[model samples]
Target: MKPLLATLFVVWLSACGAPEPATPMTQAEAVSIEEAWIRETPPGAKVSAGYMRLVNAADAPARLIGATLAEAARAEIHTMFMQDGMMRMRQLENGLEIPARGQAALKVGGDHLMLMGLNTALTSGAQLSLQLQFADGSSTNISVPVKPAMGAADSHAHH
Candidate 1:
């Protein structure tokens, strides 16, 4: 009877030691950009900001290399960092990364798309076409509406 009990204990231990199931590897479905919008910057400003939600349904990580919009002469990835008690925006030369099965948000005072050389003011309710390039040699086109800049106090709001 003792030997039988030992055998059962060993079986239980083996069961407990089993490895967890592996995450399946599947082709990454093209990412989707939702609620894309350019903030309404003041007239004659050299820079404006854009924000959006990038959803990556794929099982692997992906990188967003660059973007383009008709309203801006150039688009770039930018990040805000606190330096010497001040928030400063800097261009991200390496681009943005979206984790597997996750999402990254481009919002104010964080990772955002910079719209440089704005030809016109981004008035509320105006829509613009933007193109996003990915690391996999694929790209996506999205239509984004212009909106008022989020107030300083309300910048943390998320969908």
Candidate 2:
């Protein structure tokens, strides 16, 4: 009955196999990301904006220092404001801060990510990767889905 005993031991070993452990999460990955999107622009538009809701759940504050994308020459943090009855945009120097346990919104008509020198049109449904750098020496890469411009309802599939 040696074969029978060997089979029983094999079954027991298989049944007692250890469960796979979960991978560790980084500090940047622990940050909350919500409603992240990029505006779809027409051909020759040259520029586009990205918006998102960022929440810092850590005990310390977080700062968004810069961003990088392959499709754009450069990206900058900007704030849109009304000045003298006219809308204007300005670069946010020294980065933007998100207080601990607080939220920072990069949305339309306010703070946003400005993409400049676009190599091609940002059509709706296109999937692109953007790397957001923070002051803590950590960065997170996000896959952003392109959405139609404001007031538009076209659903372009990602290529």
- Number of the predicted model whose TM-score against the real structure is largest: 2
The alpha-carbon lDDT assigned to residue 74 of candidate 1 equals: 92
Give lDDT per model, in order.
Answer: 0.79, 0.82
How many residue pairs clash in all the candidates, one count each? 0, 0
Model 2 per-residue lDDT at 28: 74
Cα lDDT for residue 49, candidate 2: 85
**For model 1, how does the per-residue alpha-carbon lDDT over 43-68 read when each residue is reduced to its tens digit?**
76667778988888887888898998
Assess candidate 1 and give its TM-score to the true structure: 0.75
By summed lDDT, the worst window of 10 consecutive residues in model 2 runs over 150-159
